[model samples]
Target: MDGMQGAAGTVRSGEVIKPAIAFESVHLDLGGREVLRDVSFSLPSGSFGCVIGPSGSGKTTVLRLAGGFLQAKNGSVCVGGVPRSGPSRDVAVVFQDYGRALLPWRDSYGNVSLALEAAGVPRSERKDRIERLLTTVGLGKHLHKYPSEMSGGMQQRLQIARCLAQEPRILLMDEPFGALDAMTRQTLQDELLRLVSDSGMTVLFVTHDLEEALYLGDVVVALAANPGRVDRVVTVPLPSPRSQLATREHSEFLRLRRELFGLMQDGHG
Candidate 1:
């Protein structure tokens, strides 16, 4: 259902009129070095999109641009119909390094509650919301556990819960699950799909893992290195509620994987 249905009797709205996030002919130069070039694409509201590319391809730089950490030198980066030139509360970023994303001294709940607190959410509401989010990410039992005491996967879940606390229009993730073990990574992937679908929030994730990108993204945007630019955008044809074992065997999944691999190969040229 993607969790947007509000009414049964009334014909549901065709689609919510959510604003677009896009890069219009964007170029980025970091400290005199060209990082991204002519990058442009528009993501529909509530859609999950991914940007994949080779090492040093500026994939993370694009995420920064989207998060307003870096501004485009040649074109523009827009979020919800306004030009985003600096960090704003409307955007939330989840980085690969949980150690950096999380506060070292805070427990899981504390980390998430702080974000809600900063937003001026009532203290009572913050506690309730933090509990719900930790539970949603399967961390309910570990709410009081500090990051140093938790496993890598739990730390990552805490990071996700913190992002959810912000209630941002867009979630920007840079290789968020890349550091976890295979089994933990897959488990978190399923949880992420469930969370994003339930929340109906837009996500722009960056990863070099082709399989991870296909598994999580509604549309996968491929890029090339050495002055990165969009190479192609591929849509995942597999239906929702995708499972690790079953989805790998789906014919459409295999086909899409092959096509994306070919495109990535071409991009490396």
Candidate 2:
């Protein structure tokens, strides 16, 4: 928890604020099979946390539990110091498959507007909010285009724009960039970091890529499968506003990448 001191909580004079998300010895069973066991971690308010592990390590399940889409068989998942009983508007999720997440018939503007409508925002207020959200995700000019008409990256950006419309306090992403090409993935990664930083929203992102986890996370939590559980937590000391090139080239980044790679390899073997 060395590097976690500053990122996990607000330190004023000397006290640490409560974490924005907390998993307390959480356990889960899915389809009669044990998925997560005794998993625990905490993300401080406005910090970015990444979960990386081999396939079937319950990475997505962790995100689902955090979002209240699934319940833990034992233990608790808490947000803002309260045990989550169900999904709250304060939390939003972005999935890997943008094609399915978005409506093929709706244009980017309509898609983002749906969230505002659901949130009960008035018609007069919805336009500006939707426009701003879409622009924030770099979809300003693509407003009238349908999901089917846009590229994979644009669709994903639209999905994120819709989520941002929720004004969420926590963003849960499940391998959101896994489907994009390398160039597009890196661009979206930087965009996501900027949006999260500016909005002061906490994020819990799950990915199979070790380097990605290190690049975007303030803390990287590695889970081991076969009754998935927290294996280790590494504090990423990389400076904020990380660059795709310079940050990856940093000695600490390389060091942590190697460390995490070994951890994952060992878990698999």
Candidate 3:
């Protein structure tokens, strides 16, 4: 495999780590129906790539493949150069349904701490990191609160906090904010942008919302439904510390969004 230079000059495995995630000639089939066909792309390390398409277009399937949840029937799915066969320990997933994902018995802090315990981080350091992660996600006050005790927004934050404990190389998010209210979803999107920037983790996000994908992804990938294949890829050119107001008003932002919307619509048709 030839290595391609990633952004920031980081060397991904196989000599190039620029694209932290890559799917080469990949295919998937379930129940005699082809889910994805010949899908391919590269997401650089420390960058964000969001998958967009119509419902049942295999957007989630791509993330699952990258996370090792679904295996590619053919081709290679690699993270940092190594081929992925099953779920890689270096990857962490945050799903849309935070309530169902988190253990009901555990409080916010406990949920995050469980991951740390598995990682063998010392108790003292684990405590410190958990606090930091929770605080970073704006959940410091809810540290002791259980899922039932917190709002939908806060519980999603807890899921993110737990994923942070492992400090995964790639963070795979599957419509994490889709179930939240509009206001809450916006707030979480802001927090997630900051989190990805600060943590320097490669992110592969799955979403059906073009606006959301535009807001979060360094590159937005649109997949066609029914065969779930890559239709187009658009790179986001917004400046850092992207504020909602400034980003929405930026010329390039609007351009990219319009372009992405067209691409998505094209895929749908």
The lDDT, on a scale of 0 to 1, for candidate 2 is 0.91
lDDT of each: 0.86, 0.91, 0.87
Best by lDDT: 2
Q: Between 1 and 2, whose TM-score is larger?
A: 2
lDDT of 1: 0.86
Backbone atom clashes (below 3 Å) for every candidate: 0, 1, 6
Provide TM-scores for the models.
Answer: 0.90, 0.93, 0.91
Ranked candidates, highest lDDT first: 2, 3, 1
lDDT of 1 by residue, 36-124 (tens): 88988878999999999887678999899899988777898889877887987778899999988899899998999888988899886
Error of 1 at 152 (Å): 0.7
lDDT of 3 by residue, 77-196 (tens): 988877888885589999988989999999989999999988888888887888888998998878898899998988999999899888899999999999999999988898899888
Relative to the unseen true structure, what is the C-alpha lDDT of residue 21 in candidate 2, on a scale of 0 to 100? 94
Residue 151 error, candidate 2, Å: 0.5
Error of 1 at 96 (Å): 0.4
